[model samples]
Target: MTVNGWQVSGYTHLRELGSGASGRVVLATHDATGTPTAIKYLVGDVGADASFRNAFRGEAELLATIDDPNVARLYEYVESAQGAAIVMELVNGVSLRQMLRANGPTDPESALYVLKGSLLGLHAAHSRGVVHRDYKPENVLVTAEGTSKLADFGIAMPVGREAGSSVTGTPRYMAPEQWTGQAATPASDIYAATAVFYECLTGRPPFEGQGIIVLRDQHASAPIPTDPAPPPVHDLLRSGMAKRPEERPQPAAAFLDILEATAVAAYGPEWEERGRRRLAERAALLALLFPFNDPAGGGTAVAETVLTESSGFGGPGAGTAGLGAPRGRRLGGAQKALVGGGLVALLVAGGFGLSYASLEGDPVESSKDTDAPVVTDTPSAPVDPTTADPTPPLPPTPTSVPTATPPAPTASVGDTPTTPGRTPTPSRTPTRSPSPSPSTSPPPPPDVSPPKIGRSAASPTVIEPGTCPYGARSSTISATAEDDRTPVEKLRVRFTYTLNGATNTVSMFPSRSGVFHGVLGNLPYPKVITRIPVRVEALDAAGNVGAGTVIYVTLNNYCTPG
Candidate 1:
């Protein structure tokens, strides 16, 4: 079956979201499971292009290997003699590009929040040796929940490998090495991310010109705009956009560290939460502008209606609307009816139109209203150092030992020389002695013990049921860790929970100081009892690892009887 002239057999096509140079994106639902998904297809002449086809397929393959909260998930890739299509998770949010255009520049805290998510996503790709060549605002999708995810891996390639001879990527955000025809590396990705970061701060790109050549030159030599940003952010922009690739942060993870430190120092400990809440508010406001019905269609009734009416496009009732017109002449009574029907379907079905065509230059369509509640700005209290556990120091280096001095040389004389001259006895050859061997220092003690995970607890072990928004149950998880031979470098908490019968996991960041503390907000679903299993991992400077005991928290909507 086909929906809107696109040949998709198992999935029912709802509407066209947008069209770009590569292909078109459409909203579709699976016939068997009834799952709503965004299908990107290489259509018409673009589908025939072998290179575009290969890239479309390549994007799906690359996405398959990545599974992170900050990156969009890929469901499946279908290819045929006619064209190619990629089925991916439909993020119900606005693009960062649109957000910037609508809201201008973001505050420092909000920008840092977005940057942190982007860097984590990029780090996931870099860990697998993949480089997102086209890292720009257009590819970042900010969901209604205030979570930012990286999208459009169409131009993504392996690290140290070139996509082709021709340079690819949005010129404004391209790195200096990319302009010079060098292979895309983690550093290059960092450069592009920083460019976006600059845009988030200044409401404009660092370098802009009339043509690609001028843009190239500007990126190669133009000084980064530090005047718009506060003093603390200047160093970040400078180091990320350094002219030489070697000077930039090698891997995205390294840059992420610097960004987090800067954010905390500038905005305080609760900076991330504040920024995310701001994004959530902005996203909610954006949703109000373009309201659409949910396409998932609660049951078979809505689904059947969409399928039956869409299939009747060219029937007797087809001419009743203006959809049957050959070209662009004029709409008659029947044409008007058809157009009206399609528009109604578009609105009711919540499918996107071609208005999202310009992916590179213009903003694209957002998803249906999530009805998620507005997150309030609640600053976290300052952590006390005296109560926190201290990190263990590394072992000392082995001391060196002095070598013994050689024995003093003794005088020697021949028997005949004594009678010839008294002076001859004085000139005796010094007896040779083997030089003492230098003492070798002992090897330093081996780092065998892993980091030690101390006590861990979650505040308010039980949450009241009926939270306004899914996943908004506010709580905090704190833990202490230590190492015998090295200082603790990082602490991470993984939360595993079941939402809508599917298991989902999210990684949470913890503060340093041999203690881990993070807030858990917004449960993924509403009015549902969820048991969240939490695990903590600590890593020392020497790479030793320690895992803490697992704990479970329950969300209950039921109240106990009096």
Candidate 2:
């Protein structure tokens, strides 16, 4: 009822599609042209809420920009006298969620097919530099012909754009950095895609039984479900659902590749078409093996046709039409054996393949556990704790005092010396200082001076605003080193990107110091959030080159929750 009534004069609401906290969506038709579309109307006081309005406008703009075949296309966006409305392509089919409800978890082959199609759309969006902050089955639609498309970019943004005034993403699907109020990366998108895969294979998300914060905690600290998948889909889902973005496939295209490979391996080559054939063949065999008691039924009809065709009795030799006396029982017996054997073999092979594919590998090694410990070298000279940055300061005072000795008598043979060089030499014991254990201290051990090129606090990387946006064309980016080692004058970094079948590159430069720094300017627009693989390399005047930390990017809100 909330969806049927609308203020727009050009469109007539037909039925409810769905609703969320911000608005209600409905199926509608344009009055003049009679074209169908989905109309989303802002509900409540969202129009009065600046944060909400900004988010709504951002989403509308993103939807308007998408131009990919795999992504749901936005037709138009307009504000009617009643409220803001967005007209989107009306996908005439059920959400993947509904399908799952009606049919339980799908077979691995079917699931992968669905996932692959979705990734293609996502890649299109990523290529254009957009990230779909939210990606889930509810936003995925299957057409009457069974093609799948990704829907909704309500919270999507250009790669480096600052997030809106309000956090605009579904908590369940949000990445860890999102929850922690940190910027997201392409790896975040990889995490979300994998989450979808987990739900598809297990009929639920990877982490269950928790609120958003709890879920975030689970994402940040808990291990991905170590349990195996239902079948061949296991590898496909596991690889996509890796907790760390880097651990997952690099891009939607890569994800699709893995999904397709697994699906083909699981169901046998040409599994989709082959499955239909196998089903038909089995049905046909069943009819022959168990002919109906009544001559008018399916079993008898099938048997008679087979017998007539096999014996070349279609001509004059054909038996009388009405229940001719039963032909030799041998035909029934042989058919049963053949059909039974074939069915068993098919089942056995299918089970084996699925079991092999579904085997989840050992838990992945976590970065927290695997990263090289931070190395902090102590300054050669002791720094004053009060004036310094409140770190790496004075050593503790010695607690045990040396015992005092009595003055010695001078000019006596048995008297100890009391004057210079006569008193007991001060004990040469070196006092121990209270400080961080050797192993616990960061590089440049506590007592050692700072290294020639001091490492800065792992300053988190920054992605400038609008670099990645939802649903547009793709482009290339370059990153250069600007550290003590490579000065801006000598720095040169280049990289490439392909969108809608076009490719280009960006040039980057480093600063005076060697610490690598560069901005990957103006990425391509993406139809969905997608990941891009990037590698950075730095070189010295001597032609000696060093590799940089590998980082990945996605054009969407793919962040890990804090």
Candidate 3:
């Protein structure tokens, strides 16, 4: 099925995914059944090393024993004088590394779901007495359905892997014990899994550093980093990434129990479904990078602007991409755009609400998470435009409207000075007998009116190519809104927009001046001008909602920022 000197035998090659000095990985179809398979080859020096070949063969056999839905299946392992290759299931999805880069941080629900699937995969390996020593974001493949499959077990070793075995793993995700050259156990794998889970939730790994030694010291000494993630998972991170292996979750299933309970208590029962949907939407944004898109397409499984770790004990990065621990550059961060500390706005009366928190939509808000707000009136800088074109409701509230006579004419948004003076005459004429509430003195009918929103605008709708995902390249939405009973500052805003035929809900937080404002990013481009209809909705403290006008946003026909 292959030439004498071919890298792999018995499968036709479609394209190369990646390669290193040790070996190369390729997309191929099985000659017998034509099933898609990914074959990782060990060539030349490493392939011929007796120790490495034996290790590769042993792990391949261990992979064959794993039949869980979450772990990629190993089909066959072939060895010859030419080289050694392990054929595996070609996961038809992009890596988690790419997903975070394109869309930024995932919602809490989606992050939980991805972590759950990954833990399940790790559970399978752990149950079989195997440990995935390199469990980082790049090793987690997110399918179109948003489910994940753990891939690349090239460094996985059987439980109690000898201490003399070199300390090997992507340094960014290495466990404390791994840094100390200690034997790897299921708990070590759990530590790496937790670090990756943190990245999914907060858009960055727990620890990243410049060199392997710096990372090693941090892993051995740094307190677990979890504040950036939703609070519900803070305990989970602490338990899994505990500095000492004994302090971490013993088995992968034990961690799942804690994860499932926490997710339900914090996000409700439908959390997984909602999370998967959010993940699916974000993954779809990178459909072109999927290996199955075109077997012949020169596409790499990475985002347009690669995301990398800044500096921590364990961060996911550009290193150790393909299978095998080949001494890759495990320290380079992916340069992913940061998705925090941006402003937000809210939708008001008559329409749905939209508040901008971070560029990844609104800051994921939760009752337990008071640090970042979704739409509630959090005290921040003013964001709404005060482009003074007088609104229609102002003519009625003129300063000269207080009539001279004892006319208790109520002050309303639509009351004019001229009408207030005339209405006093009519009420007195009919009140010779004095009407219904003479004794009760009803405290002027309760404010039943909802808030009003006007002058909505989307600044710089037509953004230039290659300038986006940063300053001056993205669009900002601003609108004027006010309430009858609730202070305008207290109203919550939410904005909804359709992307790829699916409606996505975002937030528009208010500034200190009570104006709803938000910035819109993460939309794909390089196509002709398109019209996007954004829905607006607002909520006041009194539980009243009002409709707002739809705003249209456009994009350039061609050019995408790299």
The CA lDDT of each predicted structure is 0.59, 0.44, 0.58
**In candidate 1, what are the lDDT values of residues 133-165, reduced to their tens digit?**
878887887766677888766543222223344
How accurate locally is residue 367 in candidate 3, as Cα lDDT from 0 to 100? 15
Question: lDDT per residue, candidate 2, 93-129, as tens digits?
Answer: 3455434432234445555656676788888777766
- Backbone Cα, N, C clashes tallied per candidate: 14, 54, 52
Off-target runs (Cα >4 Å) in candidate 2 are: 1-6, 14-18, 44-49, 52-62, 80-82, 155-168, 183-186, 231-235, 272-562
What's the lDDT for candidate 3? 0.58
Residue 552, candidate 2: C-alpha displacement in angstroms: 48
- Which residue window of length 10 is worst by lDDT in model 2? 354-363
